[model samples]
Target: MPDIIRLLPDNVSNQIAAGEVVQRPSSVVKELLENAIDANAKQIQLMVKEAGRNLIQVVDNGMGMSATDARMSFERHATSKIANTEDIFHIKTKGFRGEALASIAAVSQVELRTKKEEEEVGTQIIIEGGQLISQEVIHIPTGSSFQIKNLFYNVPARRKFLKSNSVEFRHVLDEFHRVALAHEDIQFQLYNNGEELLRLRSGNLLQRISDIFGRKIKNLLIPISEELEWVKLSGFVGKPESAKKTRGEQFLFVNHRFFKSTYFNKAVQDAFEGLIPQRYLPSFFLYIEIDIERIDVNIHPSKTEIKFEDESSIYALLRTAIKKSLGVYHVAPSLDFEQNQDWVFSIPKKDSPIEEPKIKINPAYNPFKENSKPFTKAEKLNVTEFYSSFRNDDITSDLFDAPSANNEENFLRLMNGRWMIEHKGQLWCIDPYRIHQTILYNKYIKSIKNHALSQQLLFPLERPVYDLEKEKLISIQSKLFAQGFDMQIEDDLLTITAIPSDILQEKVLDIIEELLYQLTEHSEEEFSVFFSKSVSKVSAKKRNEFIQSSQIRPIWEEFKNLEMPYLNPLNKKNYEIISIPNFE
Candidate 1:
């Protein structure tokens, strides 16, 4: 009763540690890749099956360990990187806590094969459920290969919590990207279910980034490099136009280790304050190098969070560096006071004299006469009729005129591109664009729901998009087809053969592009919300085109027919009213 709390068993403690270190397949991928890097691997290959739930294998050409050292590597807190407590702060390698392998082995079936460069033979070891199965001497290559299978097999609860393969694969890809980005010189390859996903060769930072994201990113990157007393920053920031609505491409690395820091992220984002649209995050790959003593990497088990000695200074420096790079690359505006040679004008010779001015005038023009002659009979009749038409007309006459029984003409007046209507001594100013958007939004929603008519195009349109975008489009192809879009995908180009009748032929491409952008922005939103937003955006774009009064009458009629004409689809006020006092 006195000693209720006692030491937990090694297996139990190891499994508990696995909860933090090996959260998912991605966590396993990260730990294994870091271990490979720490081993001074020049080339590494990662093979995964079923998003690492079934199998995860890593083969690296690095310095392998001896048999005794290999056996001891899986012991809890057994590490060669750190000697004592003093080594925690001054850390250089990726793995120092030494809990990664122990924890991973506790929940997965592990197999290890290693051979030192100086050894003539290698050792093959297999373990399951945190217990070593067998160790045998075998002849193998001078490196290490680790195979982890049945991840979380011993922990059924953890296995059950894993997400779908697509989601889990995305996380795995994220981890692979972080590790591959931090070490550009190491050759890395990734394969899923026997299909190659990424094959990165040894290159510089920029080349590595371009290889991973796509070669098109090369032109969009702005180089940033700054060396200071406290910190050194280097890498690239994307141009403002290349900014994305999602926060997927942003990365920050410290001392060759990938980490996340909201403080540092905000600093970089501040540099693009006015350059990018609101809520859009810019793609950046920034690397920060500082003294090990100035940072505590052990603050988090994942080692993604670090406490800096002078965060404020680092933030200021990072922001300034990124801003300077943007200015240098002409991605951001800069003032240049230096004169341009092409803009200079040559001075006239001293011998040349200025020319005298000459003037011409019509001296016979009359001050007050109609063409210097009396008015004709027809002109007199026109003038008399024009004056008679205004006899009973006043500023308030038309304002008070009600619509006729025919309803062909509208009483709404167009002033400065806005519609104004007067009723009961009060004037209402309406935004025609907003009202039209609401009307079209409702119309399109109904059309989509009812499978409205689609106008087949005489000439199909083809648009080129990236691989990721093509995948996204394919995922929602059925929904698009249901919405009156007859589209076909051929490689990276999307060909449109038909579109909704209401959407103009010329605006089809623009509407599709807007839809894709919205898809990227609201990927996590429900399908209903996504569909509504896509239709609304397309309708908004069409409403911006110039419309004649005749065309506006029909749109205004539709708007009036809406149940909520005072508000747009987004619930924003579409018009405002003001009382104008009549003074006699």
Candidate 2:
């Protein structure tokens, strides 16, 4: 029998690797920007066309590569960061695995031009489908420039899955922001299809934050700094009052590399407990510094997820650090001042007599008690016998089996906005109030249980996924896979033929997409867990808003009324039938 396995072609290998590194336009942006940052680039210019669907060019004033290095850079597993196993733990620089360039080149037509500062001549190299097409020595500035065109072109399956231009562009913008925020001292400029997006000059962290997120963030950030035995925490947390309903602003970094940590985020959230509203999530940009051996960065190919040797110790330290900062200053701003200005309470005038009050509420009764039953079988029999009275009348033949009259006088609105049939011989009424509540409750409960189905197109359905996301996708891929998802992966493109369990719902997809962006940009934290908590927070908030008192009428009181018949709908006119004649 022939061997079942054989070595794959170079292009296939590159495409598979690209699946690990370049999930979307944002993935390419992250890899290239990291390369620039690692090169110690002082100034970088980024230009994108069609939200990075068509072109992504990065020009950096950093140490350029030689003719030989430029050509070899497109090979898989190629790296200048590590040569031996021991060096993995004691790592400092970013972009270590060297799969980023090779993966990116696999999916796109790439062009590179560079010259070292000391070298008078530069080198130019071009590649398509992981195949080198040209290499030549040329004269250029003492920097490197890379232009990636027709991303995922070789993989039509991936290209076919791309999202709308606006959506893909937003992903590109997100990547640009993260890289720019991490290295605030580096000059970075972003342009979309020749239109200038952001030009960030070297500045302080706060300055960078303000430029990217807007000046509103300036007032919310409070400096946080603490040094423990080995680990150091330094950054800013948004004031509790400024917390947002959305999770777009939270960021956590480790030694300048962006990361997400649920444990650490909980520490931050715990510190803000009681300071912010229950449903609100506080924003922060925190970074921790620890010794290299203390944490492992080489766990994944992308090196975004790190495992700590002593997690509990780190958690305790982070909690204490955040709480200590909160103790020193008021984090929740005083909104009472504004409320006071806009709203003034006036004391009721003593001379004004109160209008006639509502009739005294009936005493409550328990359903378990034998006599407290709202309806008895006898009442239903009586109603049926009464119908016979109308059946004998030839002149009122239409009245015998006619639909129950919906008259307002005979019906009373239940606290839940439902109408009870109020029939007191010769009178009929309906209550619309109760009708609304019943409809709403049924709808809400059904929605929560997944009875409702909604479909949304996966934007950029054929988009590439980065290494950071490859693990995430793989982790959740099973859940999606079980739901009839047709997951096909090629160089840079991941096409989802089916969406799993309605993850494509507008709300669900938005959060998932945000989580993907967060995971890609910040590689240090456990975002999935953090996001699960966020999902809980958001779900709880939605439930509260959906079922709040304003959304429905009070039902508990009406549910327990004295002297009610089992078959008669509870209403004002049923007093005689239940022996509560003084109900008026």
Candidate 3:
């Protein structure tokens, strides 16, 4: 018991370090990619199988290692990037602690093949669970190739904590994007399970961004460049219109190394305060280049967090730089008196007298008249006839069938964006939006479970989306078809030959966009739940606008018959009751 504080074994220490460096397959991807960059690789290829559960491979045409160096690279604290304690302050390379390879090898089966450019042959080494299995000279190219198989194999608990393939792959894609973006001149290729996910050729930053995200991002980006005494900031900020509900596209890099800093992100958000909607985050790819001594990047094992000596100054500068760029690009409104010549319209001279506006009115029009044309049919119909007509018309009659014809006194009345009704001698104030969301949620869920009715469009609608979004849509194409969306992909454009009968033609693009956003934001959610929420969100917005119309009564009818009329799909209370006795 007194000697319990003894030093841990090398393998145990390496495995503990692995917890920080190799959190998941994506973490391994980030470390290997950075190592390749540090080696001055011009071309890097990343290959993964089963979202990196089975295998992860990285081949880079970099300055390969020597036979002796290759064997020592997997040892704890073995590094060439730093020599002394003072070297950490001036560090520029990505991996310096030397724990990356050691930590990675501790948790998985790692294979390494490396050869110096001047060498004729390479050295191949295989290690399993931090134990060297074999090392031999082999005839390979003058570069380095690393294969990590059975990741977290020795740590069953860690392996069990991994997410689904789609989610894990998304994280891997995020890491790949960060590395490929920071170094635009380096060619990068990524393949998932033998299918090519991305192939980014050597190009400029803008081109790299466009290739990774979609070509549409090119137009959405607004260039930002500024140089100050403490920090030099440069990169792109997306337009306010391009802001998204998710934070997947936001990136911040310090000296070509990707990092996450909520403080810096807040600066960007503050600059776009009124430009974007609340709860929405704008996309940004900002790179801050400061003196290596001014920032500390070794604070975290992943190196994604940096501590700046002058964070306040950097924040102010970053905010001003982005704000200036937005104004310069005309993305933010300007109050300059100088008008755009293209938008100028000549006003008619006062000499040419202005014509008086004409107005038309029906003097006999009385909205409250009982026998009026609009009110005659509505007033004459009883509850039974009114609901029967909805059923005959194939509307949501089944959802709203009345319990009894004598209970017609429980009528629906629209007031201030809510539905006021009398039920069980109590006044109920219902949020029509939430109630409609519940109705559509169940309806769409049922439609998705069965085959939804598709309304063929007279003219097909073509919408242009990003390449990644196109892939996402393709992955869920069968589910979309089941939900009454007949979509066809041609190039980057998605054509809609048909849509759900209840969806408006004008809102198809908006609906699809929201659907894809929800899907991307919640990839781990069950498909049925995701689809229902997406449909409900889109349909809710439209229903909110529709609740003001004269046709709201039928919608309220359906709301009343819901199995859970008091709560929405999100579990939010939809209505509150005002007891008649309490009111009296």
Candidate 4:
């Protein structure tokens, strides 16, 4: 008999933890930036090379660690943030789970240089794969400088899984944005491959937002704040028109810690229900402040998703805050900014109308000709010969059967926006324009779409998304596939050659984008009925209007039955015309 279980090696244990903590380069960025913020640094500088694949360095002017503390900082579970198990529930600082440094060091080559403000000398600690390689007392800056290089170098399998440098770099940028947004009082600077990307100076929250996104967005944002009994909510929400088609601009922070909460997100969305177009989501950067004891951030490996004692209250507060802000801003009501701030002057004179050009029309081409009236049943039957002349039996059969399948086909559009085929007996209808609006709204609300790749583009086009949006993109791969996007990762770039559904591929990209933006906010199910109804109406209208045999002679001549009378008994009520109902 032999023992069945055994302890895993230090390297293996560290690697397993690293898998959870450092899923990508962005994970590393989150850890390092959090550590800097926890250190109470007023200024933090982030620099990345090759989208963080080559190098990721964070230099912060926070309170530096002592010589002894610097060496111990690399040890797993060794943290100054938490004293015991009770401290886990009341975590206030960002880097409480000492595992970040240890996990980070396990998967990459890490070098730490830190010194106290009063001390003349600083300590440098270097580690790789959970093993300390070097520890030296060196003269450097007053805060902390962490450099992580050759990530997953020892684990080729993990390294191979790494997306392109650009993708990885986007992740880093995301982490950088989260911390920067949370702590507006701290100055943050970021450089990528020797190019200055961000220079965020310490100031008000609005200024910090402008620094990160750009000055153009500042004017597009509305201030949102609400102080509830236990929770304090404050942030700026983008005006409905300002939200982008993608999921790049949403930010949520809990007690200065960046985290994701679907409950909270729903609250914000509920608030903007009627104001924002269904196809577009509101852009917001909101921070929630609550008691440390009422929340828990220690559950997840990376500490991104959180659990609250009273999430419903928090959610409601968020929704109300955003809604109130929208009301105050009068976003829907067009504001006369010109009149609001007065200093008007000149009055302009009105001009007369311009002359119209005369257009001569041929009597044959005139739609309003004396004998041109709506087609009657006899006329429709006569025109059947003309319609039949254009195509072969297969095309004719399909066109004839199309009316029967209209309900099912339209229902499919309502259910999933694009298409889905089901039995016609199960569907209903609504206003088509409203269906379009609803579908667009639903898609926009769930900005991340999973579309399948149809075909690659002939030429590879390169574009950029904020580094923070990488995770969101990765999360939305399946939806993108459903939407018909064939995408691949090459560094920070997302190469798209194909779309998910064949229908979207046929349409122009701009139209597709419009559909996406519009349908994202509404309920696909609700819009389905409307969509079906509209499609059915239009299709029915087209079916009733029959043309003469002479007009369609070239196409319909082959299938024409000139001798047969084309009488439709149920043209308006039903598509098919039955000769006689058999009553038994």
Give the best candidate by TM-score.
3
User: Model 2: per-residue lDDT, tens digit, 385-463?
Assistant: 8877774554433312334355322333345433333344432222233322333333333443453343445553554
How much is 283 displaced in model 3, in angstroms? 2.6
lDDT of 1: 0.82
Order of candidate numbers by TM-score, starting with the best: 3, 1, 4, 2
Tell me how many residue pairs clash in candidate 3: 0
Once superposed on the true structure, which residue ranges of model 1 sit more than 4 Å away at CA?
1-3, 335-449, 452-529, 537-584
Candidate 4 TM-score, C-alpha based: 0.63
What lDDT does each candidate get?
Answer: 0.82, 0.67, 0.84, 0.67
Q: Which candidate comes out best when scored by lDDT?
A: 3
Steric overlap count per candidate: 0, 34, 0, 68
* Candidate 3 lDDT over residue span 1-584, tens digit each: 46566788999999999999899999999999998998999999999999999999999999999999999999999999999999998999998998999999999999999999999999999999999999999998878999999999999999999977876887888899889989999999999999987899998999998888778778889999998776789999999988876556788999999999999999999999899988789989999999999999889888888999989999999888888887777887643423545587769997998889899999999887788355565566775586666655454333333456778534454546666666677787777778878888988788777766899999999866655566578778998887788989875578999999877788787778777677663466677778787778766754347533345666777876775466787788888987666555
Q: TM-scores across all candidates?
A: 0.73, 0.61, 0.81, 0.63
lDDT, candidate 4, residue 355? 60
Q: For residue 290, what is the lDDT in candidate 2?
A: 90
Candidate 4 lDDT by residue in tens digits, 1-584: 99989999877888898888988888888888888888989988998887777688999999999989988888788899989888887777888877888888888899999999999999999998879898988998899999999888888999888776645665677778888899999988999889886788899999888777766677789987778687888889998866655666889988888888777878877877876656466789998888888888878887888889988777778876676667667764333422433446656456855568899977667665577577899989889988877767535333122434334132222232222222234322222222233333333334323322365667644433334444445644555555446666544456567643323333424333333333321323433333223222222212112232222222122212322123221122211222344598
RMSD of each: 7.5, 18.9, 10.0, 15.3
